[model samples]
Target: MTPSLHPTPATHLPLTINDSIVLQSMLGVGAYGSVYKATDSHTGQTYAVKCLSKTGLDSRQRAFQTHESTLHSLVSGHPNVATLHKIVEEDDCLYMVLDCGVEGDLFYTITERGGFVGNDVAIKSIFGQIASAVLHCHSKGVFHRDLKPENIIMFGQSVKLVDFGLATTEQVSSDFGCGSTFYLSPECQGGYVEMVKSYDSAANDVWSLGVILINLVFGRNPWKQACPRDETFSAYILNNDFLQTILPMSTELNEIIKSVFCLNPRKRIPLSDLAKRVQACKQFTTPEFSASFASSSNASAATATIGQSGVAGGTCFVSSAQREDKDQGDSGVDVRSRA
Candidate 1:
């Protein structure tokens, strides 16, 4: 009755590989690095993976990475700011995995949609969200050197300030010129290299924010209209003529923008007071504007089901639940991603 017994082999789970997190397609590329849409194998979550090449790992790049690491360490649990999940290194490349925004950058959204959101109440509500995030950054002593629309992401009702690659600490006196030229403060662009040594990064960030607000309202740079040439643009900003052009916006909104973009860094509006000034604006109290703002806020949530992959070669999926929601209203609004 004794029969031959067979030994069983144990099964092991497959190890996760780098390639498994495929580069669906390039989201965007710049001098610093390129970002990609990658799927995490372990959790099947989508992430925006920013990779810094070996050749691009200069002193500036290293310094940026260090500052970003510090910021992430300090504000680890903040919901309004983008969360850094992991930093993966493969040979010479450094990959930063971050929470992917389903709705993508706010700049792209505004640029693609040809509509002016001039309702003051709507502007105030959106501005509050942005200011809250920026104030949090200042409280942490981290100044975002580059705070343009391209760096701000919108997910549902929340807006996160991303691209800390150009961000710096309070003690950092001077580093390489990093920010976009269009958003740079006067002192930052002054001819004297030594002048930047005295440049206050915090105030500079405020100026950039003002420029962003102006762009949001006008959909174009205030200075861009005056000086089409690069040299003229530099001259215009240095002479403070750019301030005059921005004054055409409402008196309250104009004052807020001016306070932030003051040529004298010491006179610039501190992040602590931004929320109060934004609330004081007349635009924040109108019922019609409030309704419009609420609708725009919902627009981001509505587009959440849009595919993370670009329009090149991926299969876009829209669930039945999402379809039903889309059919409820505003089905005519174009949800195309920017090139």
Candidate 2:
């Protein structure tokens, strides 16, 4: 995991923007800018405004910002995505007016609960919305290269996908190492070592979704990176059911993961089918996730991360639940525009 994923509290923001917009608080923080909770004084309406400063952006960065806005426009119509109402540009910065959510994100919620298991109803409702949003993007030829708990804001069980900075219109990209380590697909981690020509961006999105499923049930990543150097991933490569040892996974859930986590991207399950499988899944966790083994699960979540620190990026990914004391924002997921 990159150190940048840890969202820090923004200490200062303009008192107001343009003329009637009053910036209330920080929603999310990212590489190029930070999202703020703002209001329209004239209309007395609320919005989550994503602010991007032009001060430090170079030619490439400026182009990347434009590209992100374009792709986000293509898929923002979806019900599960955060709506980008309009773009307002000033001499100093760019502001994106978006849907306002008073409730916080899934990352903050999961981090607080230490992974809520045996609640298939809430999991299904949340993951189902996420699947619909991803499928909507793929249908429009836009790929959300970044998909994780951090990028999703929750309204109880419902979710909205955010942070299109890493999005792309390309069907394939040779731009290896574009996302965070834990959620990256094997083909995406193709740095100089693999010399990978290109990989299917759509398939790459599916792999990230698979990791997210593991996170929903287990409250931890299945492995750090999909690379062979990682011990847990290597064990899973040799024996498909290795994840069962770390977490109480059911056979049905295992089947779905196997299909999604297939080594061959071409052989990976289609998004439409995958969504149905997820909706049909009866149990993602065994009886162990109940009160009886709650303490045991917590102990194991800590140990698994220690034993299998991921190789890429030279950082270990601990569960968001165990990583911090409290989350500081109600909305915003900031993924760096690595691609």
- State each model's C-alpha RMSD to the native: 14.5, 5.8
Query: Lowest-lDDT window of 10 residues in candidate 1?
Result: 327-336
Q: Write the per-residue lDDT of candidate 2 for residues 1-339, one digit (tens) a residue.
A: 122455564435555776888777665565567777888899987888777777777888778777777788889988899888878787667778777765666665566555444567777888899999999999999888878787877755678888887788889988776666677888887731354778889999999999888777666678767887877787788888777765667888999999988887889998889899989987776655544444554634543443353444332334554233222321224422211
User: Global CA lDDT of candidate 1, please?
Assistant: 0.55
Best by TM-score: 2
Pairs that collide in candidate 2 are 111-321
Report, for all candidates in order, the number of backbone clashes. Answer: 2, 1
After TM-score superposition, the amount by which residue 283's alpha carbon in candidate 2 deviates from its true location, in angstroms, is 1.9
**Number of the top-ranking candidate, with lDDT as the measure:** 2
> Residue by residue across 145-246, what tens digits does model 1's lDDT show?
776666767777676767676666763446534465556776666523234455787777777777666655544444421222444344444754443332
TM-score of each: 0.68, 0.83
| Candidate 2 TM-score versus the reference | 0.83
